[model samples]
Target chain A: MDCLRCAYCNICPIYRIEGWESVSPRGKIQLLDKKLSNRLVKDFYKCTVCGLCEVVCQSKLELTRIWEENRAKLVKSKKYMPAHKKIADAVLLYGNPYAAEQEARVLLNSPSNVLYFAGCMANFKVKNIAECTVKVLKLLGLEFKVAGKSEVCCGSTMLRTGFIDVAEKLFLKNVKNWQKMNVEKIITSCPGCYRTIKSNYPKIAEKKKIDFNFEVVHITQFLERELKKLDLKLGTVTYHDPCHLGRHSKVYEEPRNILKKIGYKIIEMERNRDFSICCGAGGGLRAQFPEISEKITLERILEAESTGAETLVTSCPFCVYQFSKVSRLKVRDVVEEVYSSMREVELKI
Target chain B: MYEFPNVRVEVDPEVCKLYRFDLLKVPKPFSAFIRTPLAVFQPENVKDLLEILKFAKKRNLPLIPRGAATSAYGGVVPLKRSLIVDMNRMKNFEVENGKLIAESGAVWFEIERKINKKGYALRVYPTSALVSTVGGWIAQNGYGIGSLAYGSIAENVEWLEVVDFEGLKKVSGDELKFYVGAYGTTGIIVKACVKLRKNNPLGVEAFETSIDKAVEKIDNAYHAAYKNAEKKIFLLAREDGESNDLGLKAWKERFFPLTGYKSTFSNFSEVIVPIESVVDFLSEVEKISKHYQVNFARGEATILIILQSRNILKALKIIKIAEKYNGRPFGTGIFFKRKDKDFWDFKKKIDPKDLLNPKKLKGNLILNFAGLIAWIA
Candidate 1:
């Protein structure tokens, strides 16, 4: 709450587009400080929850958490956007925010020590990410279970949009399912899902007096270790850090390492790693404010294109989907890059 | 409520409240006097600014021109219930002919980054440059990070396009003194063209020395400032790899003065003392509070003293001590109005109606009594 009112509004993706202080991180904090929940609910939700403000913050305010907790408070006050309400409703109704049929879920029901949580986005929206991830895992000789139909939403969108109670329910369900399956480790391609299960789930579980033993990780973290760097040239490509993975989970170098190991010369966008520009698909922004989200996505896409890299590679499926929508440049998940590299080596043989 | 079809205007109580204050945290006891702005307006261009001025003239409402609101001088704080002209949306800049021509709301760091790509750098920028706006630095005290070598922003500025009640006109040379660091009382700075230098990589070094010796070491360096009250000099020069990790850390942290100390104190005051008097001035500051810092410039040291326990008395005592050393509080915004008579004359000439950022460059009852309160205490 000790916002110095420095107004570092330029760094914010939402504020950069909206050009309003009310939508900036500092302004939202001030609004919350003043207890203007009615105004805070609308303005705060405009954010993509990218921790750029935190990265540039002199105060080092944990601004993403502040936004989330404030959104939770606003939700308790029954003051939230209808879009956020729709997300809560969908998560409750379909066990996932996408409202996809249980039959459409690609469940690898085999018993294994590892569970590949494809998240809601990979399962429904971008199915190739999950399929490629499965192929990559199989190629690496790892026996893992994909929580397809049985998988509950990791409660990332729910937590971000301030449906913590609903998110907790889903989290508990998923944790219980993984525990029953004797899952020791969970890996996911979705940064949102990875961050939630790896970071938020344990915290929430502790608060609720529930315990689950599973090592959660993003696919990049898993692939960077398991997938050996083959002798192949994959050409130059730029990496876009998913906000949930880079700033939220601190999984920056793993993705870059994975890319470098796959034989692609990484031409970094000017804003890369912790300082990376968000892909504008996280924190329920793409689901709620598609136009602003797309504009932000376009900004990142422009930055990526400026690098002159042939492909825009990222680990998050949401980033892939969002960038694919507006970006003319090629977008691929890091797993897809690895899968392509593996296939290319096979073709060479 | 003020309105322009192209401009964004907000009268929401919550939004206005956010614009009501700046970096200055007026304690609860005295904060009641600071009024929430009637409205906040974001004008995107010069045309919108003129329209807002015309509307303000008609309404007889004073417009507080605000940049990043990084200054703690109450320059952007609306003393009387008035409209806030948020200048951030007008951010547009270009580097041409070895100068950066920028809208007043363009961030200093952003402009520096833009020019750095073109192998040009700002002559002087506030240490708060990361968040401070060009107009904010120009409007308030602009002697900061690079001022050790380049002097104040006044010396570096080529011209400023200002819009007062009269009309739009470019002011430079002696006229800039009336507007630059006048806290927007003279006129609203729409755009400015400032001098730039070659973007040379600066190396930093830490020196443990006396106050005067450290100030002496700052001669012709890119930047030299006291890292803390411990008299450790964090000096930046044109040389390569002349610093340790602490010096590099200090160099990196120049933009983050408000970081890591948000809860340390309730309020702070910026004071400027002659280079000769820094030793005495700092000694006096040490007597009162250990939470103070000094940034050395060409011939002066800008000192920031955290007021102990949010005590107005202690803050006033520090100001009185600074005056003894022939120093004055930085920026004449609602607090220190002793200097800058030319600003008063210019305000009378340009904004006789005082429609542009009123209640600054002058004091209210509470501020006027600060000295007396200090003396009595």
Candidate 2:
């Protein structure tokens, strides 16, 4: 694709705030085409892999795939940012990037064929999202078991940061654990985990020559199918599209459909669907450049704030966590919002 | 070693290579004219820009000023190993007394948005407004969607702050005209004060018609709207019916497609004529296209008679026909045939060394030669 340098890609959250061509998507592509220097390597980590660039791309270039591949090349050459190394170490040592202790495994060994992989974020950083997913699954009367402590990092961060070997190991371990459970379906509230398991894991498994089974579905997709089961009356709320769920996976409609069925008035942000901005927490951005990450997050919150919606609903736990940090408006996972509304209606009945 | 005050100089071969071309829609042979810059510079303010100019002048290196690089012609394309001064970092916008005071690099769309929030809008803007910078429009002497109502950027601009090797000077009236369409030959426009209108709703009407009927239909529509004394009417005609939908989408998004089939090399001609001569000029274009066996499309696309041909000779023939009908190439840059002798004389006086965008002074001989080669090869 010809880079017109039209500055249409200037709307990127990181590029908009940083105001440097070196950090912009078009700039990075130029840098990659020429050669990757230490500065270019540092700039690559600045991207959150939001996929906004790909969506707005007039050439429809596979920018996300290109970025990921370049990142892998950088990692192979040992030219990656130090923060990525720290995350890799933490994931390897603790089975999570957060470096929390791995308590006794909470494998229920239930006879249920469904499994809820809460991921690392939902497990520790945003536990309410996990509990809410469990409660909603129970409310639906579906037999499902939580991965609990047994679930390792889905290796999304490792893969995104170019630690392919580390990601492969984690992928194999997670697949083996799930195979032991004999599950037919896996549901995740975290878009990172859902995207990795549903998309990236298959590629990794094929490379390792491992047979992987079990259908992977995000909670939004699962809840969308079971939307008729719940009775809810949610207030006017704006929905934030998680980059992983909306752009990477093309799961835009399910979350919006679920919100509409729950009786909430969906006030759309100016940038929605494929054009939605990132919540500034994905692709190891929050880990490597927290200050830049916060600025991007603030910009997103302001966009949501402009909608005048009292509540901001999303399907991904990472987006909820990031927005909740700086947003005055209530930030919630779609499952949590629906579950609470369902419980309220039950009490009223 | 080169040094400038408060400016970041990038000599990275990778980054410097990207500045080699603007949005020039020419065939591959013509692309050979694009020359890579020796280095790229980002100046933060007028002071930095002045210092860079001085530095370039002392060394006698060609200095090319770039903003957004959205020029349909090779306005910002360097002629040799020049210093490309990217002006995007100097985006400072302020509004006072119904006037927009913006730095040259301030994006036109961003300025429109800011002023819109304050209940004001720009008098005129280019179709490429989303990515086109205020400085670029001034340099290119642009006219677009609202030109029929507000005239060109030259008419809308009130004052300009221009920097040359000598120093900075405030130019207006005739002096400002030198910079418009001069393609940065005289000096660099660092800041501009443009007239703003009250944010008024524009009534847009789209219709489908054969190329034969397009010019008359659009002219009659404009007259009819004028008779009604409607605030303003923006008329756009596209030869491809399918493109109308794409145009509408672009209008809604307020952005031009950055990359697409349109970005490919082609023989594209944009000609502007007096309202009375538009029909005649378009008919002539149609005749030439048929004679040359060129796959041509003609219509009133964005207040100009745009004739596109797949064949290079056919495109050149159409441009020649447009001149016969008293039409001039639209926009002020390398694409157009006519030169403003007065502007050139003024540019000679100010930029005596002609070290800024020296390619603008080179006649269309190179383009003509390339077009001939393209037809043969």
Candidate 3:
């Protein structure tokens, strides 16, 4: 391993706050070394696996993969962090991290070609993107069923943050639910939900006898396919690229094109696309380390401010919810584009 | 000299974009002090300084002098081959009858802002010209975007004043047409007087035309009107990229007359092309863009053109003709013009020292070494 002589972590915000190697890249690397070199069972599952170091590192090393590789090694050694184990167990028992899984369900009973998988965010936050997406679908004149809160956690949050056994159990449970619904395609807005259902499920389902023949789509890809009708209108706004939605999944332009069509003047922030700043609400920080997470959220807000934007818009409900926590600026999900048409306005000049 | 451990040293590690923050990279030893000599020597005033060059000569200690950290191309940094004598601390500015006098250390932003608020303009201005000290701009023969009309730094400068490392004195005026943008090849620019405009000229912009027609119209129209309305006009074309549909383009068109002006690039990306090959390159782009679905006047390829004259109508006519030639026009803008001053330093050769940044970009020479200075080994 190459040595970082600057040792930026000497003053790394997260490492300083936490005071642990597991939270720092250098420490994480050392832990990985011990787990790989020494035969001891390292508790590798506790990390939030946030890519903050990747954001700050001058060398631009991929630190998240370091977290994942160590997790895989811990799995081999049969070691786990308590918090992740509890989360994995909860997801296995209930279909989501939340206890209200069954009550969150609302099946798509209508004749629809598209299944709107609202994921955990909309299940709890509901109105942010859910209602707006349905309105947009109706405007496009395409048939879509609101899985209303009915869709089980695509089991994405469980798979990530290292709860492998529980994640595997969730994969088995959700596959049966998906099959029962005659699901052909699953479209979700959450990056965590999108990535988990799209990438992680296939890995776990490889040995299952469940012959689920369907495709998983993020709402962004789905929206790009239906942008002609989104002819929804808009004004000047900055789009926040969520970490899961951006650096993780590499989906950048679909939403910008959508905003453009709706007549909104898109004000691009300086750090955009792959280099997008994090909302600080992801990778378990929201629950495990609330203060640090909020700092990241504010940091993203500061980035939006640099653009002199009139509004902050994003595709994920998580971003919408996190952004709303700030009283300083205006924030919205793509759903607001739909909700606006229902209102009438007269400027008092 | 005390023996020391090995370490790479470079002067001017920070590349200035006129912004306060710096982009620094440690490189070979000489790069650091090649331009900013005062960084090492915390000496007293200039009373004792002329004695040093002679003293250094006896001991063979090479001397390097530099202006403010304002050279656009890293021109003001000291050479590692010698001792540095940074001249930023020297301040000498005089104002009279719309004319301003400056020492080597005087900066553009301070003077321009002061003159601008008072409704006046400088004699010469480069893009980075404002940030650079008077001595630095003159020595480098700097060029600004108003290049076509002003014809680079050499054309705008009116006079010069210099002091060689050996205390030699040289003075020139606009009548002689001395070296500018020459990067201090001459002596140190101690004090120089520059020409100034009676009116304040701050930068303002508006959209005009879209395509080659934009260029053609602006060029022809400006020339057509120049007889009666000769005014200095500054123009820059860009690649703003194709809007998704007619409405977006139409919106842009509504804002600026889209018929003559078009764009083919995104906002804020740079276009610094070789001059001799530009016209031919523009012509080829004009013909081939049709198949690529670039219907806008300024798609994929755009050019920057500056027109100068006192007549404003000359500029308007050029805009009209630019419209006829298929240009996606934005709008017109106003800028305060600063007349060029004689750069006494570019003419006098101190030395062309190699000051290299340690972290070089792709395909760059990391070691730009020179043989003048006795460095700490």
Candidate 4:
């Protein structure tokens, strides 16, 4: 790609916070083009794969695809980072990237053809998001099954870091489990999982000659389709578009429309929609570069704070996790916001 | 023999390689390829920059001052095993009265956002404003976006703080003009005070018309718009595509659909000409495009022409046509064809060793030829 260096790096979180071109998208592309030694492998791992670079790219370089493919090539060359290796090992050993024993955090009250795939983050890390997701599903009066402990890591971290072999195994295992459940539809609250399962899974299935019959949808898309209206009013809040859900999956309007239906005033961050900044929690960045990830998260929080909104709402659990840790403003997942509003209506009765 | 500050110079090959090229948007000719710099020095503040400049002068090491490295003409490309002075870390900005006094590394978009909050905006900014540094803009003396009204960055600049072997000096007016478009050949621009105007959104109206009609309309409408308008009227015409007016509307609505057009190995030319000769200039552009079998269009102004073609020869032929029509290529440093011996003389006095961006004086002929050859090869 002929990089015009339009200076979109100015908006890139990793480049802005780290203050180095080596970690910037342009620098990474240069390194890839030169096919340099493993010395710059760490630099490639520094990106959050938030798709901000691709969105603002004047050349519209398929940067995300390049990054992922290069990352996979790096893994094949055995030049991948050790931190990413650890996450891959965890996924292989425990069926989850977190290496925790799988347990049903929220049990499904009734089994249905529709499966709620509460991803690794929602299942173990952010339990509230999983609970709220279930509550929202129930509030909408839809019979859905929680995959619970049956859900393996979607291998998003592994896939993003270039461990395609390991990710394929996890993808196969998840697909097998879904097939056994006989689920017709899969809904995920995590954008990372949503994107991987919806977009990435079919490719792997096609290659592996496996039948991946289930249709996948994010919680926002699911809720937008099922729920008629949310009557409660939420005060002015800013929406943070999770990188995967917004840019990766092209699901920008569903969450906003859901919020609008609830009578909430939405203020936009300067960087929103496809141009939305990352919470610095994706693409295995937080695991490999925690300090840089925290700095990026802080920047996103500051952007949210700039809007003077009382709350920051996001559709992805990972974004909520990152924003909640740093932002003074209340960070809520779209599901959590919907559930809370539903609960408020019940209390009024 | 001079000893550099321990934290200032980085000899790491990985780090140094990052500064080897700017965002020139074209492949370097095989012959023009330069080795990665021996080291990269990132200055955190003006004092650090001055010290580095002094050290580079003492050691007689060629130094290339870089800000965002977004120059389209390889102005920041390191031509030898030199020291690359990375100026992005020197970001410090403050507003005084109606002017912005900022360190060279201060990003244009960030400055725009900050000043915009105060009901003021930059008088002129590059199209790469999101990533271009204030110092780089001044150093390159760029003209873009708002130049139709405010003129080039050099015109909008109130003052500039530069440092070389001669130490620091704040120059304004005619002296400041020496640094504008000089690249870093004169001296390293450490900071600048740029003029600002009240932040008023310009009303953009797109018309579907041929290049001839568009040029005529812009000439008449621009005059009327400039009479009392806070912001200058800008126009864009798409030559061979679906209506760009709809595309512009989509962009304004923040739902930009990806267009199938990819500018691969395309030749682009931006030229400025007299306002009265806009129609004639456009006719010449059309003639060149037809002769070369390339696509050409006007953007925002009659003088500004954009040409896209996979054939490098056609693109080169178009550039020649622009020159024939008295159209000067627009860019920072030596990208433009302007010959100024006085500026070079002044540059020699300030940078006696020519340590700062020594390759800055090279014309676009070599660069364009290199792109053409690379594409053909």
**Which candidate's DockQ is highest?**
1
User: Which lDDT tens digits does candidate 3 get at residues B1-377?
Assistant: 11111211123312111111111222345334334232222112343345544545555555544544333233433333344444544545767666777776666655765676566666455433323467656665544433433344456555666544557455665433433433443445566677766552322222333333333433211011000012122232212222234223333222111112223211110122333333454454333221111111111222333222223333233323333345422211010111234322422234222121111111113221211111111
Instruction: Please give the fraction of native interface contacts (Cα pairs under 8 Å between A and B) kept by each candidate.
Output: 0.62, 0.33, 0.00, 0.57
**Candidate 1 segments whose C-alpha is farther than 4 A from its true place:** A33-40, B1-3, B206-213, B229-233, B239-244, B261-263
User: Each candidate: what lDDT?
Assistant: 0.80, 0.73, 0.49, 0.73
How many steric overlaps are in each model, in order?
A: 0, 0, 118, 1
TM-score of each: 0.94, 0.83, 0.46, 0.90
- How high is the DockQ of candidate 1? 0.56
Question: Residues A231-300, candidate 3, lDDT per residue (tens digit)?
Answer: 4345588998877777777788887877776667888875678556667666555655567767767877
RMSD of 1: 2.5
- Candidate 1 similarity to native, TM-score: 0.94
iRMSD (Å) of candidate 2?
3.7
Which candidate do you rate higher for TM-score, 2 or 3? 2
Interface RMSD of each: 2.5, 3.7, 17.6, 3.7
Give one digit per residue, the lDDT tens place, for model 2 in B188-241: 889999998887554444333344443445432211111101111223522222
Residue runs of model 2 more than 4 Å from their true location after superposition: A1-7, A104-109, A205-213, A228-236, A260-264, B1-5, B11-14, B25-39, B58-61, B121-123, B148-151, B196-209, B213-216, B219-338, B371-377
lDDT of 2 by residue, A60-104 (tens): 678888888988988888888888899899988989988887663
Q: Which ten residues in a row have the lowest lDDT in candidate 2 chain A?
A: A101-110
Name the lDDT value of residue A330 in candidate 2: 94
In angstroms, how far off is A69's CA in candidate 3? 3.1
Q: Give candidate 1's chain B TM-score.
A: 0.93
Candidate 2: C-alpha RMSD to true structure equals 5.8
Question: How does model 4 score on DockQ?
Answer: 0.52
